[model samples]
Target: MRQALVVRGGWDGHQPVEATDLFLPFLKDHDFEVRVTDSPSVYADPAVMGGVDLILQCMTMSTITAEEVAGLVAAVEAGTGLAGWHGGICDAYRASADYLQLVGGQFAAHASRYAPGERSGEQADNYVPHRIEITAGDHEITRGIADFELETEQYWVLTDDYNEVLATTTTATRSWGAWQRPVTCPAVWTRQWGAGRVFVATPGHRVEVLQDLNVRTIVERGLLWAAR
Candidate 1:
């Protein structure tokens, strides 16, 4: 059986725990021997990481030690697939450029309405409705998936040319006024890192956002496609 590691824990606002809860069962049902951890320290253990076929990480904006980052990178370079969504993967380990380079992008900002210190009811009001368009419809990760709409954070990411962009979302002018002149950005992308594959999606800030049928399907397929 394939071994999968899911490391969760970061900014609570991203709901890393809840997000992992939504997908762990799916991984298990797919015949993976899944291991769960809330700490990044596990990445430092070469013995542990060497056995992992897939690393499904959900750490957002957290710090990772040099040893941990090196072990994780080496494992992926040796053919262990790495996958995740939202800030958890793409926006994690802000201090580590090596991590961002491996992931192929970093979260620069989000198109949100809620300003600092502003609260709308219980929610912070960072969501904006947007459309996700399939760019590489023939790719395994996005095959048969059509353009879909969702109300979520439209991530403005700093990406590299190495990504095989499968889907994208455009920023609405209404959301950012002059700043949002329909700037199209990659919503889903895959990349090759040494012998491993890296998969990422930017629409999964909240559980409900990921619960979108199309979104869930794309993510599920991405995980499988990235796995070794």
Candidate 2:
């Protein structure tokens, strides 16, 4: 059986645990023996990481030690699949440039309204409904998916040209930043790191966002496609 690892824990606002829980059963249903952890120490274990076939990380905005980062990069390069959604994967380990480069993109800014108790200013009032376009319809990750609408944070990610974009969202009328014209940003993408496959989706700011049928389907397919 394939071994999968789920490491979750970061900003409570992202509900990493709850978000990961939603997909745990799905992974199991796919015949994977899933292991769960709340610590990054597991990444430092070469033996443990060497055995993992897939890694679903939900650690948002956290710091990772050099040892942990080294182990993770090595594992992925050796062919372990890496997949995650929202800030959990892409927005994590901001201090580590190596981690960002591996993931293909970073959470530069979120165009969403600030929640209660969050700093309420003009800068935080950009949440609005948006549509995700299925760009690479022939790709396995988005093969049968269609364009879908959602009311969630439209991530303004800073991405690299290495990504194979599967889906995208437009930022033409966003009120948060200074960009006046519409810019198409990647919503879903896949890339290769050494021998491993990396998959990412920029949605899922909340559990409900993941619960959306189309979002769930895309994510599920992305995970399975990325797995070795």
Candidate 3:
């Protein structure tokens, strides 16, 4: 049986526990013996990380110790799969450049809904409809998945060229923001870090977002694909 470590906890606004809970059964059903924790300290334990095949994390905008970050990167470099979505993985550990490099992207901001003549600059104001375009048809994680749309937080992620971008979303020109040109960002991507694989999706801001047929499909497949 494969082993998976689920590390969750951070900004409660992201509902780390609730979000990670959505996939526990799926992991168990797939023959993975899963362990759950609300801390990143486990990554510092070589013995624990060495035995794990995958790490499914959901902690957003939290800090990880230098030791923890190093261990986590080493584990992935040694072939442990790393996977998560939205602010969980990408928006975390902003102080750690190494972790950002491992994930291949950083969460910048979400464009506000910009409804003309309405209150803006808040969470509800930022929740808007966006399209996720699958750019790589041949990739195993995205194969057969068509483009989909959702009314949620569309992440404006800063990504590097090293990522194998399987999906992308284009941002719209907003009247409230200074930027006039529409921006295109990677919504889903995979990175090969040494012997391990890393998968990420920017769509999962809420439980319902994760439950989206296409979003769930790709995320589940991404979890399975990232296992060592």
Candidate 4:
């Protein structure tokens, strides 16, 4: 059986528990021997990671030691698939450049949705309307999915050209924002690192976003696509 590891923790605002919970049954149904943990340190355990076939992580704004990062990267390079969504994967390990390089993208900020007269933005301000456009419908993970819209956290991510961008979302200039031009960022992307594959989705700030038909379907397919 293929082994699947889910490491989830960090800011509860992202709803890590309930979010990862949504996918547990899917993983089990696929014949994966699943293991769940609350820490990324588990990556450092060779006895555990060496035999793992896939790693699905959701911990955001957390830190990983050099040893742990090294182990995680090594496992991926050796063909272990890595997959995640939203801040859990992209916004995670802000302090680890190695981790950022592995994922091929970093969470920059959400387009601030300001109130009628409010100068400072609130948490809810990050919840803005956006659309995810399928850029590569022929790709295995996104072949049947169409472009979709969502009123959730629209991530403005810093991404490199290394990713096989499957989908994207464009952010328009908001009155309360400082930037003047419209921006387009990857909403779903896959990267190949050595023998391993990496998948990331910029949506899923809350559990509801993950529950979206298009979002959920793509993420589900991405897991299988990334697995070794």
Best by lDDT: 3
Per-residue error at 58 for model 2, in Å?
0.7
Positional deviation of residue 83's Cα in model 3 after best superposition, in angstroms = 0.1
lDDT of candidate 4 over 42-108, digit per residue (tens): 9999899989999999999999999999999999999999999999999999999999999999999
Measured on C-alpha atoms, candidate 1 has an lDDT of: 0.88
Candidate 3 accuracy as TM-score:
0.97
For model 3, how does the per-residue alpha-carbon lDDT over 63-101 read when each residue is reduced to its tens digit? 999999999999999999999999999998899999999
lDDT of model 2 at position 25: 95
Give the per-residue lDDT of model 1 (tens digit) for 72-184.
Answer: 99999999999999999988899998888999999887666654456464444767777899999999888888999887788988898999999988876553345736678
Q: In model 4, how large is the Cα lDDT of residue 55?
A: 95
The Cα error of candidate 2 at residue 67, in Å, is: 0.9
Tens-place lDDT digits, model 2, residues 1-228 = 899999999998788999999999999999999999998889999989999999999998898999999899999999999999999999999999989999999988765554444656643255558899998999987888889998878887989999999999987644545668877889999999999999999998879899999999988987898888
Which 10 successive residues of model 2 have the least lDDT summed?
Answer: 115-124
User: How accurate locally is residue 46 in candidate 1, as Cα lDDT from 0 to 100?
Assistant: 91
Off by over 4 Å in 4: 115-122
Instruction: Compare candidates 2 and 3 on lDDT and give the better one.
Output: 3
Better of 2 and 3 by TM-score: 3
Error of 4 at 58 (Å): 0.4
- List lDDT for all candidates, in order: 0.88, 0.89, 0.94, 0.92
